[model samples]
Target: MAITDAGVMYGLLAVGAGLATGLAGIGAGVGEQGIGAAVVGVVAEEPGFLGKGLFLMLLPETLIIFGLAVSLILMFAWTPFAAFMQ
Candidate 1:
């Protein structure tokens, strides 16, 4: 069967969703790299600072979570996709 307009639109939406999640994960990884190294150095010097270092390291993870949320919204809740579904 030939591809319809809706199919093309849905494919683009899927690509957008994938990009959102992938880019967010990449950004988080890049952000965590620097913080991870610093955290390692701090924990090496002061074992007592481990908790604080861990908290700081985890902060970058929120970016990934936000990206996931956006992708979910795009796939399931965006008005165009919702309309296309009906």
Candidate 2:
């Protein structure tokens, strides 16, 4: 069957959403890699420093959350997706 305009639009939207989330995750992972090694060394040397190390390690995770928010907004609040709902 031939694809309609809405189908094409929806496909593009899905790809955009996937890329947003995937890229964000990759960015966070890249950021965490270095922080993780440093945090491990700091914790090993001084257990009391674990709290600060943990906080630093978790900072990159916000990127993923923001990405998820963007993807959700694109899927649910974008004009084309809303139009298809009705």
TM-score of each model, paired residue for residue: 0.89, 0.91
Residue 81 in candidate 1, Cα distance off native in Å: 0.5
C-alpha local distance difference test of each model? 0.94, 0.93
The Cα error of candidate 2 at residue 48, in Å, is 0.9
Which candidate achieves the best lDDT against the true structure? 1
lDDT of 2 by residue, 1-86 (tens): 76668988888888999999999999999999999999999899999999999999999999999999889988999986989867
Q: In model 2, which regions exceed 4 Å deviation? A: 1-4
RMSD of each: 3.0, 2.8
TM-score for candidate 2:
0.91
What does candidate 1's lDDT look like per residue over 3-86, in tens digits?
668999899899999999999999999999999999999999999999999999989999999889999999999998999988
Residue clash pairs of candidate 1: none
Model 1 worst lDDT run, 10 consecutive residues: 1-10
